[model samples]
Target: MRAVTWALALWLALLGGAAHGAGRGSAAEAQAMVGKAVLYLQQHGRQKALEEFNRPQGQFRDRDLYLAVFDLQGNGLAHLNPRLVGKATGDIRDADGKAIFQAQRALALEKGRGWVDYKWPNPQSGKVEQKSTWLEKSGDLIIMCGIYQ
Candidate 1:
């Protein structure tokens, strides 16, 4: 009985830790990541920066928060989804039927940097959840990083 209790406690602690680490990123972190990626892009050029941004475990990727870049025309230059890259993605809608990329593009065009909220399926929870991305316009590129709420 004593050993069983100890094992249960350990399992619960590990589960909590996993949940905490999974969504550790915040809105501020997303903004900062976009800024960092812009700097990296200017320093490294497009091809190299795209490779780094697309890297699953690269510097631009922090847990679920990862960098994605799209052109002003809504063509994905670097995205988590390889299929979206080099294609028009502005028409993609959220579960709620919101034109997410169009909204994001408006923010980039008008404000140059801001947050856009949408809903996405959380793979871990297997349910839809709120997500917000901080995006910045870097010349023709719209760089972004999102935090799961």
Candidate 2:
């Protein structure tokens, strides 16, 4: 009985550790994906990176997370959403009337890399929710990937 109880306790502890690790996994993966996209832009150049980013089934896209590249002036250069590509987003705002694109551009230009939060419609839920984007500047453009909160 004692041995059995000890075994059960060990198993539960291992299971708990695994569950905690899984939650951290997704956040780390999102950051890794963004970092890889930045590297791709540096090595392959913007034109090639944009081509890849715009591809429907390209590596820059994965599940609910994908890369969106914009010029410093808020013009959408490459986006996962087909409608947003090639759009002039200088005055684009979030659901709450926050100028999200401008804020993103400012963060990228000032800090060169950081996270910006705003309200957006989640593609998975189709409902507006708090979302955050990790932003980094690559030469004349800003590279970003967002996660819905």
Candidate 3:
């Protein structure tokens, strides 16, 4: 019985570590998405970049990691969420009453690129969860991609 318990605990420990590693991998992949998107925006210009970002079946849409672009004024220029596109998000708040878009925009503008953490609805799970988004300033737009944690 003691050996069985020890084995089970070891298995659980390894499982937990694997999960943590997977989470880091997802974040890294999301970061890469943002970097690739910045390059795409820089090379193609806003119109084409927005079109590609909004494309449902395009390279930008990778599972839950999708590209979003918001103008410095906090207006959605390109988003996977159809309801958000062309909407003013300057005052949009998360579940914690944090002005999520404003914070992201400010960080992108202030630092030129960084990550912002906020509560967001995870589409796959349909639940509000902790999310971290990587932001990059592409001219007048703040490009982003997030990972749910």
Candidate 4:
């Protein structure tokens, strides 16, 4: 009985640790994505870089993805998603939206990299979606990439 109890506790602890690790790994990946996009834009320029970024990777289409760029003053410059283009994403109001924007701002101001999870509203169904955002600062510009669920 004592052995079984100990085994169960150990298993639970391991599971919890794995879950935490996975979350950390995901945030790291998101940060990397931001860095890659920034580097691409810096090296390739806007049109060519976007073309390459949007190109289908494996099974994903660039149109089905979201990317945005902002100036240091938090004004949007461009967005890969036409719908979001020119919108002020920094003042986003949803709880998750706010969190994501805050993280981006902090990264832009301090680390030059940011990652956060948030909810995106669906256009057709008016439902909120879970999403992750990655941001990186390049000179006076901030580039953002987002993955939605």
Q: Model 3: what TM-score? A: 0.83
lDDT value for candidate 1?
0.78
- Model 1 spans > 4 angstroms off: 1-22, 123-126
| Clash tally, candidates in order | 0, 0, 0, 0
Q: Which scores greater on lDDT, model 2 or model 3? A: 3
lDDT of 1 by residue, 17-107 (tens): 3433555665556667898999999999988999999887789877667888999888988877688888999899999998989999998
Which pairs of residues collide in candidate 4? none
Sort the predicted structures by lDDT, highest score first: 1, 3, 2, 4
- In terms of lDDT, the poorest run of 10 residues in model 2 is 17-26
lDDT of 2 by residue, 65-137 (tens): 7888899888898887788888998898898899998888888878998777778886766789766677788
The TM-score between candidate 1 and the true structure equals 0.81
Candidate 2's TM-score reads 0.81
The top-ranked prediction according to TM-score is 3
- Candidate 3 local accuracy as lDDT? 0.78
Better of 1 and 3 by TM-score: 3
Candidate 3 positional error at 30, Å: 0.9
Model 4 scores what on Cα lDDT?
A: 0.56
